[model samples]
Target: MQETLEFPDLLRLIDERSTAFLAAVAAAPSLDAMVPTCPEWTLFDLVEHMGTGRRSWAATVAAGPRATAKVEAEGAPAVPREREALLAWMAESTRQLLDALREAGPDRGCWVWWGDSQSPATCGAVARHQLQQFAVHTYDAQLTAGDPRPLTEDVALDGVEEFLVTCCATTSAWPHEPATIDYHATEGRSWRVRLSADGARIARLPATTTDEADATGTGTAGELVLAFYDRIPLDSLELAGDRLVFDRIVAWEPE
Candidate 1:
């Protein structure tokens, strides 16, 4: 089973990363400036998305396990237009999420969208998934501000698994032939992903596992995570074997 960070640890990172994102927003050239990564969004839009989404998730957690959570899209309050008010709203959004998580605790069951396939119905899973979103969007904010920073090694490592479970693994059938891809991190961690009509299956490779995969990608943990999120191109990693299959897997998205 994939082990996620402890609940408290996840909370800590979420706070740190969200704070960083807010700081980037504060220092950004303009709220109207376009985000290169998310072309459809401005800095204001980005903040609204994160803040509002966090509030929605907070409601989900507070509702307890298996409860139908309220959604912001369903007549929620509008986001503030002013920078200072928006920042304060975002901060409060984070605080609410943190407060909800703390009260529910990790083991408490929660209604998560991933179902039982990618994650368990627990608040801990919500925290981990939220961390990934914060990490990625934080990078988006930084990149938009022309001040991108590297992800912490630990977050990047966990992010790979998180991305696979939450985004890559799906019940949809793969149209292409079966293949295996190996990811080797400079830090000695490695994972092997088998792609087939059965969908994508990922497992941490045993030390004895052979290196002869149909496609192999090598890079630092951070680079791999960034590439998975499309913050960086696949070519940034050293690759070998079937480029076509690798590209196909990289481009795969759930319906």
Candidate 2:
């Protein structure tokens, strides 16, 4: 992994991924189609979620940090007629966000809710969170459309790394009763996470889950993120050790 990566690069990567995800979603046939990972959410629901999510993030970054600002974008209307328009809107909104982040600079100071993460430059939480959301949502769209692609290990591992550190390691998002979690990616690639009770942690691990774990989960890193995010079912993972640990890890919020 590169040392001290600037947030602009992360934003660029996220922007590329956002495009990739939208393309996959466009590959889908119908909004009513069922997503394999998120059985309850239809393709329509996933598309709407992505659009609204982009709007919310764009608003958040623009607001310059606060205690959860209310997003102005109207909630998804009751009747969605043209899914294609919504998908295009998602793409353009994400592109605009990338532009904003580039202008925002990693070192640029700003207000934030977290104690140590008050700076937009250093506060890397929302970036990683949204990336994972796009990844899983893309996967969901792919599965729902009955067309799946091999998730890039480099990309998936990046997501796995960020999720472990930002979400599992710290309860900054939850702020109370925060338990940490660690993700270990097998397959002998570079990926793992160790989230503990003290401000949660993330780092590359030499091994995936094993008998030594409180619980173990085995799957592709992409699958792991999807499973963790509630987009995928529990049975999808091959588990061992303490299932509770794995379950607890997945139960955390997206923030």
Candidate 3:
């Protein structure tokens, strides 16, 4: 299994790449490049979205048990008009957020709207949540800037699995079910994820063998990651048993 990371992992990756995104924002190709594996966003909007997400998480975490919703459908702050100024603003905004997250620390209490209503005091799960969000979006920004390689398989798979399990609560695109899916990597790693009306709950796989799933598929980790994001072709899956379940998986979307 890939070594798991705490919330600070994101703080680190964000610090390293935020500047990369800043330096290339204007020169970066038009926002039209769909985040390849991420699909729903253009590079421009993805960076803008993540930049705002940093603020949203900070605000929510700082607020403690009572977090409020303040969404601006427009997404992100307006650009400063001057290219250099915009980059600086973006760069500064990200760094400031990094500082805010650091000062608050993972132990600070938080009320998150997504995933297993959590307090930052017990923050390992929160780290997984924020890390995947930031990592995928960072990939989008990097892709827009013309560097398209994905994060390491373990990282991508973590995010991809997180997205799949959480899709029911986060979007109407998925057909919600109480059924569970146990994910296994050929490389001796597995995560058992359950999706239900309560949303997603993930746990480490049990050592004992369970019945074969209603359906199963196998492929490279990267391909599985893209499929989870609706970026890869579902038919590409190698399935055994109850193949129709695969169709439903293809239909899922966060929207």
Candidate 4:
């Protein structure tokens, strides 16, 4: 895996991108317009989800495992119908989350549902996770507004690594038998992901010539990251070798 971003850097990214996301929400022509990428949600629903999710994560950071139940409780805060009110509420909730994360510091223990238990439950992990969440949702918001912008190469590359380790490797939900596929980012990073009946494993490959594996996907880091999340289709990527292998891997849903 690539080296993770420092906690402070991740926090900065969350702040920057989330501000942009809220701006998109503010500028949306109609809150009722459907988000094409997230077909089930309207713009209003998306903003509400993002805001409430921040609050839940903030609670988790502040209270550790004990906050899980409270975060999951029914009747989470509702998004205001008025756009200005919704924006203000989102801003306040985001600040609460940022404050909680900052007070906890990078090394402070917190609760994380994904990845190995042995992995440190630090505020740094929370920041990193939230950065990706904010970045992807920002794209969703922009795409909804017909102004899609790619994430920066650095954030996209790190997001690819985080998705593999935190989401893929830690789950037993991949139903496929043993297989390997390589993902090559145009920014010049590549990863080999191995999926088996047991689970998944991922490794960063050296930037040297090597034989192609069962499948290979070449794209910008941002494209790869979005495709990995299924926010974008696999065909958005340039694929070589077995398309089926790549499709199966991407199709796997975490349990």
Candidate that scores best on TM-score: 1
Q: What is the lDDT of residue 242 in candidate 4?
A: 84
- Cα distance off (Å), candidate 2, residue 42: 3.0
Tell me each candidate's TM-score: 0.92, 0.72, 0.70, 0.90
Model 3 over residues 1-255: C-alpha lDDT tens digits?
235555667577656556555554565766555666555766556666666666666555545545545233234457554556656666766665666567677676555555332122333444456666655555556666776555666666666555544443332323555555655655455565455555445565655767656666666555566556554476665656665555655554433
User: Clashes per prediction?
Assistant: 0, 6, 0, 0
What would you estimate as the lDDT of candidate 2? 0.59
Per-residue alpha-carbon lDDT of model 2 for 28-84, expressed as tens digits? 877777777765878777777777667666655655545254344445343344877
What TM-score does candidate 4 get on C-alpha atoms?
0.90
The runs of at least 3 residues in candidate 2 whose Cα sits more than 4 Å from the true structure, single-residue gaps closed, are: 1-6, 66-80, 109-123, 171-182, 187-212, 234-238, 247-255
Ranking of models by lDDT: 1, 4, 2, 3
User: Clashes in candidate 2: how many?
Assistant: 6
Ranking by TM-score: 1, 4, 2, 3
lDDT (Cα, 0-100) at 233 in candidate 1: 88
lDDT of 4: 0.81
Worst 10-residue lDDT window for candidate 3 reads: 115-124
- Candidate 4 residue-wise lDDT, 18-115, digit = tens: 89998888777899989988879999999889988898888778886455443542355666899899999899778988998998888877768774
